[model samples]
Target: MRKAGWNPIWKWLAIIAMIFLLAPLAIALLNGPGGSSGLYPSPNAYETISNASRSITRLPFDYDTSDDVEMLKEYVESNREALSEIDKALTQQSRVPLDYTVPLDELLNASGTVRLPMRLLIVQARVAELEENPGAAADVYAKMSVLSPKLATGGLLVHVMIASAYETMALEKLIELTPRLSAVEKKRVLSVLTTNARKPIDFDLVRERESDYCKHEHGTVRGSILLWSGSALVDQQVDRAIETDDELLRLRDEAIDLLGS
Candidate 1:
């Protein structure tokens, strides 16, 4: 069964009941759930992060007014349900298993001989959002069954896309990371994750993650793990990046700058 609190609505319902059960209680709810509680991550942090995500997507050239936008709108909007699930999973969490037929990695790598340029546009939106939104990144990260390697492929753009996603992690997580990850990667993850850790982190969850995950160590150990574990994923990414040519690389770099700023 889905955990009871997985429904964020449950909290709202509690507030509404207070309106009738006790008028004074209703006024307290109006102050906001986490206003005095301090459980909420800052509203401004989210605003800044979302701003970074949008900046990455802003383009110098006009976006094609084509069917691809419609398709992309459909794809990401479709993920809205999943995004809500992400919110729940990150905060309250749940035990109920979702019935997913296809894997996210499979979906991420899903491409055919005839991919339209519009598809790349769609991918950039999803990827950028996933990179900037740690909760969403958690959802995807949960679904990543295993790791491979990074340095194998000579492509730089793939490296940056992967790097951008890592940047969203909160601070302490970044500091705890291993050395295999380049300084570029470590900072990126820290930048994303730092603000969220100002208060506290669920150490229990951190403990459950493999010690070798870049988030665990300080230097050499972390780098080795990332360099080794990320090989296959990196190869896939770098190869695809190289295929996109210089223009896509330019866009990807611009997007990264926006994500960080």
Candidate 2:
């Protein structure tokens, strides 16, 4: 039987709830140009990542093919200049906590698009992994969580696609590297995650039907475990994260079986 929480209304809410974090900066950009550019990653940067992602023949979700890996490497190598631009842009931004609020509709219709730095950082992290540099890879992923503080380690398509497949991949890489990370590195990872974890879905918000959020918490648990299969550090954290979601427990054994854990 399907989990009780996996109903249509909750599922619909899950899709839009996560976008709440972006609303403030989105409206800021729409209203004026001052400081907004620094708050969000440049459109050019996301374009670079998106263009490179498209260079691969397979879609972002496809990871089983050796060819796909090679394609990713090629894309990363050819985009050094673009990545440099992203690095410089990130260096210019202040990492202070931003506070602002506007109605949900105002954000939904905000002009232009500003992707989170997580998009570019994900590609950078993957390149680091390809270069056999785990430390660099971990650092890149850590920056992602810092850039987008509202993203949580949840939902396969819902949360992962909040930016791109790169977002999801970065989270997975972070989890996989947890056991080998140093004390300071572990602290950074934990700090960013704890700071950015998403709030529980509110049923009243769902009933209003004016705002929306995604809610595939089970997918979050399964995908997280599959990514962190070999790491004791991450397993403990993932266990704790999913323990709060009752539905995830019902699906845990099946997820483990599917991932061959």
> What would the TM-scores of all predictions be?
0.21, 0.35
Q: Write the per-residue lDDT of candidate 1 for residues 110-184, one digit (tens) a residue.
A: 311011212223343345343454433322322210100111111123223442233322112222222334445
lDDT tens per residue, model 2, 1-261: 865567788877876776676655554354322222124433433344334334333223432233455766665566566556555433333221111243334433221122423444555566666667766777777555433322321212122224333434445556676666666666655654444433443323222221111102223334234334534654453444344333322332222222222
Please give the lDDT score at residue 79 for candidate 1.
45
* TM-score of model number 1: 0.21
Candidate 2: C-alpha lDDT: 0.42
Worst 10 residues of 1 by lDDT: 144-153
Provide the clashing-pair count of each candidate structure.
Answer: 28, 11
lDDT scores of the candidates, listed in order: 0.32, 0.42
Which residue segments of model 2 deviate by more than 4 Å? 1-74, 77-120, 145-169, 194-198, 201-261
